[model samples]
Target chain A: MMTADERGEIEELLPWHAAGTLDRREAQRVEAALAEDAELARRYQLVREELVHTTHLNETLGAPSVRALEALFAKIDAEPQRRPGTAPGIAMRIGEFFASLSPRALAWSACAAALAILLQAAVIGSILIKEKAPGSYETASVPTSPGTEGTDVLMRFQPQATVSDINRFLETNKLSIARGPSAGGIYRVHVSGAKLSKDEATRVLNTLQQNRIVGFVAITH
Target chain B: MQTNSDEVLIGRIAKGDRLAMQVLYGRHHVQVYRFVLRMVRNETTAEDLISDVFLDVWRQAGKFEGRAAVSTWLLSIARFKALSALRRKPEEELDEDAVGAIEDHADDPEVALAKKDKGAALRTCLSKLSVEHREIVDLVYYHEKSVEEVAKIVGIPEATVKTRMFYARKKLSELLKEQGIDRGWP
Candidate 1:
């Protein structure tokens, strides 16, 4: 007694139902229809036969090249981290990278940190001293190199911004450079303060976008 | 015993763990490579895209929203990249190998289902299915994807997926019929 339109709809769902892809509710409905309908049951059997044929056919594809894995590993090593548009596993890497550092490396890192603090203090003092001479500031990016260890984000240089403008911008934000000014003029910048929360990263991107010396900033790690 | 799930591996991959990436690549690379090879009909391009697909996984593992299984997500990414690669190639360039792969089947209707080689006959008829039909069948049967998953991966509506499946099923049955193997249903 099922209407033709109703049967057609059920028929359309039959293959998927047989293939076991339907949601539980829909599968149950198909089961209910099939129990009462001989034609529907036959269609389901045909779908099953087709499925069997296709599955067997796909098995004939041979395995891929043996060199595929080696080539993939090489390419991964060669390419710098391109901050994905999605969330990156950066937080975990930061922890692991630091944990694996040797004691000597840790001591060297501490000394380097001290030197950086001193240099930053001096830089800030210079900006204060030159408060009256704003245009005389040095042009330095936040993270000054392309592939600095521990640095993962990227920021492109704005077309017309002067060095002094970039320096002033960094000074105002209290951000430090990790590395860059690659041939293409992109800088690898460190997130100022602690690890960047999602909201904080978005805010930083928005802030950079508004700054005249920054263009196309992104978290690439 | 419980195995480390793909989600857990992706979590580690997001953190820049190369080992995690290698583990994931080992788990899914072959299926992905096979899928790509089937589509492009070129081993070199298929191999190259396998790297590209896994590289995207390594780079974008953090973006996975868990809306679909990791395997499904990987296949979707593979499908997109394969289609893009296909579009970039000249149409005439696909002429020989891809076309020949399908038409090379024996034309003799008498031998279509010669009971001694039904499996081979089915495979030949399968190769003859249009790319669209072949993909639908592959998604449903070989990949074991649900209609919704197939719809998501193929970028078609659920209804369209069913319709495509119906036609693909019909076409496959028709091809089998031509080869003397009608299964008495459709």
Candidate 2:
């Protein structure tokens, strides 16, 4: 005769046993108990029935819509990329800091940052021009304004390329977004440092074209 | 890439690999959606919560210590989000459509008596279980999770997992008996 505690223990193991998730020893014990005890066998049958019903109930719930994936990617694109090897607490604090800002504040902050970058670029360009010897300058097909003396390449990013991917790509190529993403999802990318000669410009365009993240690239002028 | 183990995919995801994230999402989203749907009961809420769950995955992939299965980690994140969502909308009662649907299955004791489909009756009883009991039942039977995995996902003790499972099964049997489909057990 099975003790009450023994019966309860076997009863608790039955669900896991029916699920095929019990360890071998517990499973063997349950099997042995079932063989010797008709009552335990009946209980195991009920457990199996419950498993079928539960599985059926869950299966009928169906899969999520495509919108779920789309929404997830959209949110990811909006998130600031965490630096590699950054501590979790620091990253979360950074995220929280940005999240705490209002939209207007964020926009104003972005505008101020953009102005700082443009001013710094102008200063750097002037200094480089002053340091160069006359007649040593290479001519490009397109003439740039004094403050904007960089190769302008129009590029389109792949649809699946995220903001982090774009940032990494730009940093590696020493490029910055100079203008519109326009209606066509194209961005005018400014290659920093010296204005490229035609061959150099073509090489840069080719590099962008070959990259996985850039779906299209061309020297706009 | 499709054949990569979940841990491999999670490792890649931790490095900010979009393709890896997409693969992991494809592999698990259906079951995760179903699990959240069972908790939230509204398809729209469940769909939104699925996005939230995976967004957490993308943000926290690096923190996964391999202490639990990837699926268990996902369900844990999903359960936390679902519970928070539930808490935010405490005034929103149980889904009326679902309640009505259950009633439609057996309008009265007389109709329940007339219903001879034990499987259908049992399914109705499963649906009628309290959320706590239903969650435990689904975790064990439907998700086919081990007791340890369920304890991790549910954030309860292993011993508590066993007792909860026993109680959940006992309650399910009682519900079946009430529906006139008793397969005799305490």
Candidate 3:
């Protein structure tokens, strides 16, 4: 059995260590204690298990409604006090330009040497397609950011679709609009804050395609 | 990789980058909403306050001096709004709502009554904890905030964070024992 003082010290640090919030020095101390004491080790495991249960409980809470998010975006758009774009904005835009490619487009252009040729061809193709239809791009790049690039899924909705309808469709498929309404009405969407596995992304893409209101669904890179 | 860091996002947000705002909102809005939801126990109210919190972030992005993680900053804003809303309403109404909201409705009534799932039992017990204790547990376990971050967000000393969490865990352990799921911690 551990001494009263030793138990107290271990108890104090166990929660932090299990929470993965203990600083480096303190974490090392806890590790040393756990290595030497079976009781302390058992306590640490209990804390870890409890933390997992607590996390699951919290995960059950419902997210804010779609109407709430749309309102937030509309309010943001109406706000007139936007500051001028800076160097970071420019950088982010450049990053977005690359991230917005459809998976098919990425596949066609994955080879670095052929990237320039493929992109030039795709741009020409999009322009010709746009000339044929105002809101249609046979080959267009959607807008996406760094985190969303690899998981980018390209989707489009009926231009006349209601925000409520669109939001419902997106929410149903667990997709979020990352960037879009580009010249061709293409949108770069992702699996909404998740790094979905290839199978999962494919599943999301398939589910989205089943939605009648969603015109086209394709997983870009 | 570093470009998407919270500080960078805040920097872009300070420059009124709407895209940056969207990114940040997507990243943290759910957690902030959940935090606020637990406090006030009203979904609509929580949703409204979440928007309010982000609007505050949009307006005050420039004021963020990197003293705290973006999550910590957001929770601080959320907690403030939740408390203010609670103060405006009658406490008894909130207490009733909170109790109702925390119960998991998806479980079978018979099973829940006889013996709750560990998660449901824990949540039911957590709902009984004082608002102070609940938030502390939420911050550490769900939000994954460091003790220091919890202290900074809650405006308590680090030592106090540990003490509160200790007591909160003890309370939880007792509740779990009462439910026949004891792990032997005192």
Candidate topping lDDT: 2
Rank ordering of all candidates by lDDT, starting from the highest: 2, 3, 1
The lowest-lDDT stretch of 10 consecutive residues in candidate 1 chain B is B107-116
Across B88-143, the per-residue lDDT of candidate 1 in tens digits comes to: 98977785558655544465653534535766666666677777887777887778
Model 3 residue B60 CA deviation (Å) reads 0.5
Considering only chain A, what is the TM-score of each predicted structure?
0.37, 0.39, 0.33
lDDT of 3 by residue, B34-139 (tens): 9998888888888999988998888888767766777889999999899899889875666565755454434456335636466667666776677888888889
Model-by-model lDDT, in order? 0.76, 0.83, 0.77
Q: Going through the candidates in order, what is chain B's TM-score?
A: 0.87, 0.89, 0.85
lDDT of 1 at B105: 46
Q: For model 3, what is the alpha-carbon lDDT of residue B129?
A: 72
Instruction: Report the C-alpha lDDT of model 1 over A73-177, residue by residue, as the tens digit.
Output: 897898786454434446544655787899999999999999999999999998778874856655566543454343246888765455777888878877677
Better of 1 and 2 by lDDT: 2
Best by TM-score: 2
In the order shown, the candidates' DockQ scores are 0.32, 0.31, 0.24
Each model's total of backbone clashes: 13, 0, 4
Share of true Cα-Cα contacts across chains kept by each model = 0.62, 0.71, 0.51
- In model 3, which regions exceed 4 Å deviation? A1-3, A74-221, B1-4, B95-97, B100-116
TM-score for candidate 1: 0.61
Q: Model 3 Cα RMSD, Å? A: 22.2
